[model samples]
Target: MIPKVPSSPQAISKALHSQRSKTFNAFYASIRSLRQTPVEPVDPPSPADNDFILSILRANPSLRDTRSYLASFGVQPQRPKTKSEAQLPEIVIPPPPLPKTSPSLGKVSTEEQHAPSPVIHSILNPVYKRTALVKIQGPFTDVQLDSITRGLAYLEKLGMVSVIVVESDDVPKGDLEERQLLIDEVMRVVTSLERQGSHARPIVGAVVRLGPKPGAEESNTDPTFITPETHIFPSDLTQIRSSLRAGEIPVVAPFALDSFCRSVRVDANDAIAGLACGMVEAGSDNPSEDIDLTPLRLMIINKRGGVPSYARSGYPHLLINLDQEYHHILDTFDPRWKESHPHSFSDLALARTCLQYMPPSSSAIMVSHKSPSSLIGNLITNKPAVSSSLPHALLQGNLRLTPHTPTLLRRGLPIQVIRSLADIDQVKMTTLLEQSFNRKLDQEAFYGRLERTLDFVIIAGDYAGTAIVTNEGNPGSPDPISYLDKFAVLPSHQGDGTVDFLWVALHDESYGLGHPFSANPNGGKGGKGEGRDLVWRSRANNPVNKWYFERSTGHLRMGDWVLFWSDAEKRLKIEETRRGGAGLSFIENWESGRLGNWAQVIPKIPSSWK
Candidate 1:
């Protein structure tokens, strides 16, 4: 059987290469040799046939039978997985809640508490919500009619809503019919002003009869005289607020209703005070409703102008600090002046009373009918037309003085006078002078001069301002010449009327440490204490010369300096006339000698600067 094994190389090659049986015959012959089993060789498939079988199997769709056949050869198939099974599930997390806050430690301030909410309309919270309560004393003259209307129109333009009260006190104290006539006249004037103006806003007259203070007697009160109990009841608060909200200027007449609800006369000052107090009280009572109606200013537009002072030689007081000088000014009024200056007394009294009930920031203004425009000017600038401390000589046409100058009033701070320099802090004094002058000071020279000639020093409000006066004349002269040595006000306190306050102290005869002069101008020890003949010199180029020139009685120019003096001759003429002095010739000679002495001594005074 597996007989005749191919032993020759040629025979083996022939058997391997033959297509009938490839390598199978050889493998079988070898197996036969090992086990002695008889096995026959089989034919192998052709390459072309194997290709045809693979193509046919791939093309056929119904190949289920082929899978079974492939499984016999140990083959397995895999199914595709879905997207849901492959991807991970998402888990969302919300942000942590906002942390809770604790309440604030500080309380809300008065201004902040009264501040209007954002939701409030412009009508409710106007651009200029601050009110100016104008109390017009007496009827408007033909000349004042045009100016007052113009002033009111200007106030409207400046965003101030005016509430005018026409006082009928000056009109002959008559019955209700007369009061009504005065009201109509005021209405006519207001209408004329409105028509003459641009007529952008409507001007209306409100004829409201005011009521007396609660729990007070209903007895008839004179509109001309002001009493402590005189005040308007706050029944007209709603009417005022509503009118103001509507952007109207209310011209109110001063008439009050009695217990029987009949119209009667009440003090004009009382009406003004009541309206002001009502506005303030309304805010306090219902803070949400009348929040924006608080009056910032009370303007007493007087036809007679500001309060005049005999101490100022018939010049009006430009400013009044009611807290300290109220009684002092009241005392200065001669009993004889009561009839002549009735309006002056009433205006001053009214200002003090009205300011007492108003907020501290509020102020009362008294301006002349000659310059009614100053009402809005004062509101815009919050300053007087002139400094209150100007000398009387300057006011007498020496400087371009305004007869219509405005008078400002407030509850101001107290002034302190130090007769000796030893009491003042030397270090603070030096520092203040340096700051005010914006230059270095010769401290030794200044202190040395002060010690030798220091008459007195006046300090205003914690050394915010200071003035030093010195004796420049000979020790034994009949009229010891007085000189203004130094005047200094801290730069921080400059524009807020500190210098004016200091000037008031320096010229105030009552504040002098030496005997006050009844007619003498020199403010020196044991000299004519009746006057203020203060002499001082300023550098030729000093900017303060303009102010000096305005306040000085006379000035003379030297090479590098200008000599200025407030002499008794020009200023004390009124006093002399009041005294009916027949010794004018002798006094003139003595004043002439003092002037020569001042010219000689002022040049020898040492400079307090390096």
Candidate 2:
């Protein structure tokens, strides 16, 4: 049964603070029961249902006589056509990624939703064949050529990677020199395969330049949009499947940088990522086991390991043959900040050329000390994308993030302060959480929750790697307490001082620090919290409990919630009062945890929103 509401704020306050033993449990039991209140069968008159619409028309009788009103205006109704001329409105929310369990042609799955590290499902499963898709930076010098040849030999020896994709877009710039260079490289690779002693030679083909798709660039108002350049745009991937089907390696062709001669450079990272995505769209196919076995691999090799040693955020791709004019333009921006944040330079036209594009995926950008083939062997033989012993830092760390125990943090990445969920890029945020939590978030439900309950949200690193401090306390209470909600860090970035950064930032926010970041840049900041003391809860089985317990001044175990507090006095008071059978308000806060209807959208997504 639903509990009766107290008539006034004073009555509610008195009941909340009541000393009677049964009052705490009775109130809590009622609150718990309140959550279970039988919802009316909404089908009859839902906001958009026919009954509701009819009721609205009934309330305003004039609105129901639209036909007569139209007749007075000399208008007449007509039968609907097979298809309405009206285009369906543009979708605000991007579609969810393809399912990893059963990926189809051209469909790539989000890494966060799949296994912590996708070491190739083909390894254990007999259903899919292992294949290699190499996207290397072109016009290589003698040294790079030797290294690539040796790398291919090494990969072939392991038989873990087979198909190689050479794109024409990476060809060197010139009237015909760039095009010739690509053709020559293809011949070189084909020759190399034939000369090698009777090993299974990979099927090679050159994919032509796949430029912007039909009517795609229209919605792109950002004069600065670089998605098509960095990431494989989904619309044009069918060409890749066709090339693959014809036993040809798809190569990138030269794209126009201007009306005449200038050509865009090749982005090896995006090339590899793009071709692999094409294979996904083509769907998995059975390979001939009678010959060589190879898992699909996308290889990018360069002097600098695709990523810098330190972490930074931007589209993933390497710039090739930078000209003196372009170099002069790049000189304007700080080299350091430019690497960390590419969005800083989208305004400069020449600098714009430097941007490389790759879509968001579980593609981990790492600095490989070993050769390409050597890394392939390590990948096939070992698991854990970033092994504990190896000290190599992952560049573009957010892409490879999965919800496993994080490795210790090495370099301190910057934390971004977000006051409301609206300020966030919801699509990107949703993608990151889906991967982190390994569950799908209902798009509308996620937005609705944020609209009503979101108060404070903080993100660390390129993607959201932290929590939302919400559900602080009920109205009328002097100190309602705040919650640390939906806290998360990529396993690779954990232990690398991320949590410590978060702890200090939140503490400072409540302790008279500047709002740090502007709230909900989408709108205005929310009402400030009056109370300085904060409280949060964690599940009992969470591994992060040790980290929470050590940092927290005190804690309490109530039901399934193990509440922790930064305030020493408050923590002890709750602990002692509860033991003595004296009433406390902390229990109420626990009841309120994850209580909103919107909360279900992201529910217990991850443990310890610390």
- Candidate lDDT scores, in order, read 0.59, 0.39
RMSD, model 2, all Cα superposed? Answer: 24.2
RMSD of each: 39.9, 24.2
Model 2, TM vs. native = 0.37
Number of clashes found in candidate 2: 40
For TM-score, the strongest prediction is 1
lDDT for each residue of candidate 2 in 1-610, tens digit (9 for 90 to 100)? 2235456666555543442222322222222232222221111111112221222222221211222212221212333433543455644643322223322223334543433211122112121223455444344554555455545544443333344544433454454676566556666655554443213223223222344433546855646444333233344455544444443333443232322434444543334433444444333332222221122333443333432111122222221112111222244334664554332222222122212221121122222223433343232322223332211122224444332111111223445567766688887777666776666777676666566656677766677466667654444445444556666666554433455445544554442222222111111222133224455677788867876775564567756767665542333344556779765555455345423422332234343221
Off by over 4 Å in 2: 1-122, 125-127, 130-133, 138-172, 175-180, 187-206, 209-211, 218-299, 306-333, 336-455, 458-466, 470-540, 543-610
> lDDT by residue for model 1 over 125-228, one digit each (tens)?
22334567788776666567666666666555445667777775546776647766766766765675566442322222332345545543444253433434
The TM-score of candidate 1 is 0.56
Give the best candidate by lDDT.
Answer: 1
